[model samples]
Target: MAKELEGKVAVVTGAASGIGLASTGALLAAGARVVLVDRDDAALAAICSERGDAAIPLVIDLLDPKACATLAPRVLEMAGQIDILHANAGSYVGGDLVDADTAAIDRMLNLNVNVVMKNVHDVLPHMIGRQTGDIIVTSSLAAHFPTPWEPVYASSKWAINCFVQTVRRQVFKHGIRVGSVSPGPVISALLADWPEEKLREAKESGSLIEASEVAEVMMFMLTRQRGMTIRDVVMMPTNFDL
Candidate 1:
């Protein structure tokens, strides 16, 4: 309810739905001028309608490093400074290590790990110059648990978990707080869009974590004191076995 981000600028990927949409709402409510990015053009437009003029729409695949590089300055041109970046866009490919197709493996790795790192590397210089910003990477609980069947997706999450930890320590001196959220799953159009096989795999694993719950936690993390940041927060349903 506190407008901690008043007059600030925040960029969020995966903004069309799921945790990204929910978090976008929270950031807007907190009075942050938000830039919403997602590959889905129609959906992005729809989401922007909900946030109205305060939200800028970016329709680009985050997996493209070239696009990621252009994002910071374009965003700065709008709001003049960047205060928050929630890298929530990602994909899931289900398969065993030996059985996974090389193409699918590459897709998962590229989008999950490489795209995220590209965004961080590209936007960081500006954030560092400003000497104050927050970066939130969306990871998953599978990063910490046994999810051998989803080798590439799980591996990417684990890599991000490690990435956030190290970056938090390295960037604190620059007044940039880097952290990650590990969520179990979120029932969004994402599930409906997934390949039937992959959806079946994910649903068998567990129900999706609600978008609002994840959004609230992300908002809470970003609202901490100027010099403080939460390193990690993992979310799951109460009855989730893990």
Candidate 2:
């Protein structure tokens, strides 16, 4: 395998499991040293034990401004120079906007949107100073169209689309690629609480996608060439029949 990403440092938010874990493992396999950040320290430790020193587990409350501020410098401390950032941290609030509690909406916006925006703000200067970086965000299929059941999630993804695209235009000359990957519903630990039996039925009847598929697409988008500066890649399973 080509160590194209060797000697590079990657900071992946929400790296405990799901698509984040898959992406982390893929980057490691491709030879990049990784730092895993998540709220679940126990799980992150288990993952590090499995992957060893190639991975660093950082369990901090990302919602805290001080904590988030400390992230870039910590990443730099660990790897000297940062090359890739996967802004894949997000949460789901599956309720219609009208009746959804105000606090819940705020939580959704804070975790899914505000935190990511701040992560970009905190870490981007390092990339700009170095004159290189790849910023990858995990948005949802809800961004392109709409999902009535998850209005807040859809809104957050739309925000990400705007944020990343605007940054892409602003820093194109610096060679900083800002992009987002939108995936349809997938069977992930993130959705582990959902009725599996129901999901299986939906799968058989066509309703969601696989997590691995989404991760593969993310890797492709992150590693694309100069002429291939794709701003958005939307992937939905043929199973979206539901």
Q: How well does each candidate superpose onto the true structure, as a TM-score?
A: 0.90, 0.92
**Could you give candidate 2's per-residue lDDT for residues 137-169 as a string of tens digits?**
998888888777677778988888888889889
Error of 1 at 164 (Å): 0.7
- The C-alpha stretches of model 1 lying farther than 4 A from their native spots are 189-207
Model 1 per-residue lDDT tens digits across residues 136-217: 9989887898686677788888898888888888889999999888887678754553568766766676655788989999
| Stretches > 4 Å off in candidate 2 | 192-201
Best-performing candidate as measured by lDDT: 1
TM-score of 2: 0.92
Best by TM-score, which number? 2
Q: What is the lDDT of residue 135 in candidate 2?
A: 86
